[model samples]
Target chain A: MTIFTNFFYSFMASLFFALLFNAPKRSLPVTAAIAGIGYVVFILITQNLGSKPLGFFLATLIMGLLCEIAARVLKMTTTTFVTIAVIPLVPGLGIYRTMQFIVQNNYEAAVQIGIPTLLAAGTIALAIAISTFAVKLFLHFWQQ
Target chain B: MLNEQEINKIIKIVKLEAQIILENGGETYRVEDTVMRICRSFGLIDVEPVVIPTGMFITISHDNLATHTIIKRVRRRTVNLSKIDAANLISRQLTTGRISLDEAIIQLEQIIGDKSKPKILTATASALSAGFFTLLFNGSLFDFFIAALCGAVIQLFSFLLQGEDMSNFIISLTGGIFTAVIAITATQIFNMGNMDLIISGAIMPLLPGLAMTNAIRDTIQGDLVSGVARGTEAIIVAIAIAVGVGVVLKTLILMGGGLN
Candidate 1:
């Protein structure tokens, strides 16, 4: 599929999730747009560079930074945007597949899929944390 | 110049605000920070809050004396980002002196009483998200419809089971089973949609994405206890979902039904 198609799918996915999570109604468009862009970036990086972790890290970092900015500008907690934005890249499929392999008694396939999945999850988390911390540091320096 | 009753009121206000945030998917560290800020705004120094996923313990002292501690056991948690945002805004306004204690209480009560999202909205949101997710995962149009149906079924089932006092594990496990069953039945009967895509897409709504993200956020902010607690919660929910899906898949296999 084209990048635009991917972006559309990602946008719709995030939009409805924002609704499900009961995010502030007004912020739905902004949150979904950011999540869509982030997921597309992940797909592009992963496809071109052949590094899933790098893709996850970069995508989340960008998403996290944008979300923190949006939160501050919108006067909401960072969690509101960050949580919704990360939903698209949360590796749910990997977790599901790993469990599928495990239940099939396919340990080798399970481990093969599981390790990367866990690593990707970790990378996404670390990137988000870094982005959050970076924003805090920037605010601190501005205050000083 | 604060009297005993006023101090008591401040303590109550802080506790209520923290409870709202925690119960509505605010991170533990955010809860702690907001609690401390509110207490400080009320001229209560020496505040310490220990917040885990399930409960909170907070102590606030005035002038290094006259300590008040409150323990709140949070038994139910759902993902409502709006509530967290509202609580955060209220606390910010309180700290900035833009809203008085009584005003804050009124606002917090409004949040507590606010039940705006109906069941149909949630079910629809689940359907759309699952359907779009299937498309993202390269599922065909047929699979999208099947996944959407499964999503709605899972959401309705979960809503039906909401007041049963079941654990998160059981709820998610049941949700997963429902998703797999619906996806499998729909795909197998029609033999049009991709079962794998439908199952994965439908299960997306049930995954513990928020828990895992919050766990990492909590840990990075030095809330090790909450971090560990939420991390374990995430793992448990994930495993429960896996088991739920696995059980259905295993049953289908035993019955010699082709999952393909």
Candidate 2:
């Protein structure tokens, strides 16, 4: 139940974000659905595995792979799908909370929240890079 | 069978295509690849393109006769994936010999001249995105409304200021201030809504997630210069938003306004 609701909210949010970014009209729903599923997987991993970085990494890996496949099928630029679909996992809340803790003069709590935020962001980036490389390698081998 | 004048013409057209891609949030490597593909299709085999976050340089040599290079500076960048898609399509068609040079030029111009969606649609998008994000953050229905209002106002504020000569840092700073002020005030006056949830949800759209992703992608592709530049951009925008929201929140704290 909770997972479904999370998916619903994230799906709606990413759909509107795709609109805000002016993605091609035909690919809007597809990218938004990818984002929603990616975020839900992130939540599930975090809840069960108790590892936030792993969650971020896996979620972005899935999103990036989906976006690449979608780009091939739709014949659009891969960045179009990758950029919009990754927004929901951006750690906006972590950044905000870190700022809030700093403003409240709690450096200890600020650092606690800040380091994880940076780590999570780095993990997400690495996952995207890996996915792109994986796809390129697959194509290279398949073509030969 | 290509004359110097025709080579020059192809150079200009290819330059314009690359410029449009870079200026409209396309990746640096994508710009380079597109330039190479387009130039190759036009019979300019010896083509080299160097693209960074801020500019692009393309050099082409024709049969050992002469080398021509064009350096284009790209100052303003905003997210509009439709333009990137259109440009991508044009380059694909050109490479496949499905379109003439003249037709490609016409299509590229139409894409460059095309306007984004209406302001109202963008604003409504911001509203709904922020509103739904609030729910994702466990905010109540009331908080969703508050965050939606903050998101709309901030979107409009930035939209109005986008055409000005102001820097992006200033705009993001002002947006942060606006988000904090509005969320805090709405929560205080109405005596409802979670301030933390509203603030976080409202700032979601302003984060530099795309920049960070692009930075990593560029780095992995060995475009280290562009990767570092985009990484800096992402860090700066993140800091600006944090400082803006922090300053406002700190001021309220000093005034003894409990952030309940």
Candidate 3:
């Protein structure tokens, strides 16, 4: 649907997950907002650029950087907010579909869907790691 | 810089912090870095912390001599990010001049355990998250409601099992079975068309997203042991979920349940 609608659902999903994990209650709104932005970025990039992997990569990078800033601002670890913020972009449907294909004895379809889905997950992780390292280094040199 | 007694206290504090971080699902390297930083900030000259998914070992030394090594067996590790956040904050303050050693110790102790909100609160949170995730996947409102209620019940079941010795695999296997059972029943009753959306949405709460993500991050940081361990853990959890769902579905098909 609309970008706003997509972002709204993303925000809600993140907000509740933040709650489930006992994230600092006060930081829930911030995490939800960031997740919305992250999801929106993913949708825009994937929809416009026609590249799911690139969308996840760029979205994760932006989300990771934002989480670092939010952590420093909130004086909490990045994991607190990042976990919820990153959840929306997780390929949950992909994983589920792959399992469905496998159980249906459709190994070919399982591999077809599973490879790209796993690749997307990998790209997201790599992007997050790269951004996390970058932010750590930035804070490192900036502090000194 | 700390004297002998203070060094002992520092060791106690940092070890506790490291154990909690690992249990709270911090990245393996992050746990090592935090433990090392705490020891260094407390004037320990040499520090080595090794963290796996299931346990941690930390050695503190001074003057190239071993002072103490603490081994902590982490049980029931789960993702509770707020604990990690609090520990990280306390350690940062400990390193800085903001909180004294004693105060830091107290704070770390306070943050050591996993924080549990009221069961109703968490159940509602699970419901809402699962509902919104269903909507995000373009499921209808009816499917969202079904998934939300199922998600909440599943989460409550898991919460109940927290005190038990149930393995993650068993918990997720049950989760997958319950999810499929619920989705199948709900779709038949409600005349919903999208089984895929409902099942996927319900399963979102069970996916090993954090474990998988942490596995990759751990490997990226060169903590190969932790990385492989977490990766294996994630795979097993995923397989458990798949098996749980697939078995139930196949049995239903055999029984002529007529799942749409």
Candidates' interface RMSDs, in order?
A: 1.1, 1.0, 1.3
Tens digits of per-residue lDDT for model 2, A1-144:
499999999999999988888889999989999999999999999999999888999999999999999999999988999988988898989999999889888999999999999998999899999999999999999999
Better of 1 and 2 by lDDT: 2
Tens-digit lDDT string for candidate 3 (B1-260): 45678878888888878877888788878888888887777667678888888888888878734468888888868777778877887888888869988888888777764355589988899888888898999999998898898788788888878856556778789988888888888888777647777778877777787888788888988989988998888889888887888887778777876444
Best-to-worst order by DockQ is 2, 1, 3
Who wins the lDDT comparison?
Answer: 2
Which stretches in model 2 have alpha-carbon errors above 4 Å? Answer: none
Model 1 segments beyond 4 Å from truth? none
Model 1 chain B worst lDDT run, 10 consecutive residues: B160-169
TM-score-better candidate, 1 vs 2: 2
Clashes of each: 0, 0, 0
Question: Candidate 1 falls in which docking quality class?
Answer: medium
Q: Model 2, B1-260: lDDT tens per residue? A: 78887787688778878878998898899999998888888777898899998998889998856899999988888888889988898889988989887788888888888775689999999988988888899889999999899889888888877756556777788879999999999988998889999999999988888899999999999999999999999999999999999999999999998765
Q: Local error of candidate 3 at A46, Å?
A: 1.8
Superposition error at B180 for model 2 (Å): 0.5
Error of 3 at B5 (Å): 1.6
Minimal lDDT window, size 10, model 2 chain B:
B160-169
DockQ of each: 0.79, 0.85, 0.72
